[model samples]
Target: MSIPTTAFLALALQSQAAAPAPAVAPGTIAVEVAEDASAFDRLFTDAVTRALSDARFVPLPLESHSRYIARVTVTRTESGAVTAKAKEPPAMAALGQVFVPLPSGKSQIRGLVSTDLSVDILLRGGDTPVWSGRASTVQVEGSAADAPAAVATKLASALMRQFPRRDPVSVP
Candidate 1:
């Protein structure tokens, strides 16, 4: 450990083994679907383009990331209940013990359906938000078309857990 600190520690370990390995910003990622949304918005854009291409992030096809945009809106709520009366015959009284007439109960009817999906994701630089959000799910057994691929796999696992992992290189 003398010759100029061993040649500066072998040139800082050969520049940390010839750097270059922190590039998770592939490019392109646009998706817009809201034209009278339905059909599970193409299965939630094919499960968020296969979970952002399996986390490799690179799905810009909507005219080439329109313009650094990321918007996803999906609202769903379905309810059901049918039994509008199944027996009716009760409208009298009964006192001093005598006066029958009571049998009219059994009716249930509930309904409420809603579906809205508006997603527009296009990012190629500028106005950086890379991942907007808006997901809701509530179905009481109605329209079970994979429920938009389970809400696009929970919004692509919450935008891949807020993507931001690429910083570990310091050897000088």
Candidate 2:
């Protein structure tokens, strides 16, 4: 090949390598949140439903059937590492102790709850998940972050942001 033609082919290949993976075809998806008989189940279900809708996914009722199933699971830890800092609530403004500066020049804030939220999409009758994503963080204490509704909304939104997309295609 001529030098110019070879360079053109190399540039085209590089651009293709940098492109993101194609998202799963838009279609109906059944959303189901593992029930623990608590208010959180309902809140998470509603949050997931809203997020799916926002992502252009047709979330089906639990009783209905669909080819894709989005399963949500929540795991709350009794305590987690306090490595990351969180923002304090308005009520704590008067305390003037919201953030503690560390020797490393990082500020640390108190957290009331730490949880892990995950969503796994699977094909019907499939044993392995086709796509999965997880969100984990310690919510700021005394702030809106501690509210269950807020937590559900935040986690669901974060998790679904990358939904329906297969892992990136690595160029050899």
Candidate 3:
């Protein structure tokens, strides 16, 4: 209504429109695969790369070009048991009747396999680390053949969930 009030309102609206959006950190996340890592380890690294890419984080070039690094490791253990009964010996003619213990009807086979996967994400600038954390997952699968991949996928999903969403703010 009043001229001074109308002017103030217009100024307020302009200020709100001109306010800058929040700052987003620039740079990329680098992935480093250990040279001694097995084929499965490399696969895990690729899975991690895919997860980070899906999350919109830039994957930097090889270690030569980028400072940030992500490392992954995979380990597996398996145990199993087998039961076999001794065969009965042939009857001997010279000696009296030879007796042998009858085969036991109860027999069992059991096995256990475990896998441990560790993922480390490091956000770095030059030689200094801005953010760093490690995530690991363990899975036990039965005698199924496709269990390894399933376990790795589950582990990768867990790692992705643990990844931090927001970059650390730089303090002035």
lDDT winner among the candidates?
2
Model 2, runs deviating above 4 Å: 1-23, 34-36, 80-111, 165-172
Q: Could you tell me the lDDT of residue 117 within candidate 1?
A: 41
C-alpha TM-scores of all predictions: 0.28, 0.61, 0.50
Q: Return the clash pairs for model 3, or none.
A: none
Candidate 1: count of backbone clashes, pairs at least 3 residues apart or interchain: 4
lDDT of 2 by residue, 1-172 (tens): 9999999999999999998644466568888765565787778778877887888888887677777788877777645434453343322123375654334444474545676777777776776777777777676555566677888888777767766553321111
Instruction: Name every residue pair that clashes in candidate 2.
Output: none
Model 3 over residues 35-153: C-alpha lDDT tens digits?
78777777778877776666566787665555466666666666444443323454434435655544455544544455555555555544433433334433323533336556566
The number of residue pairs in model 3 that clash at the backbone is 0
* Deviation from truth (RMSD, Å), model 3: 12.8
> Which segments of model 3 are wrong by more than 4 Å?
1-27, 78-108, 125-146, 165-172
Itemize residue pairs with steric clashes in candidate 1: 28-60, 29-60, 68-123, 69-122
Tell me the deviation in Å of residue 29 in model 2: 1.2
Candidate order (TM-score) = 2, 3, 1
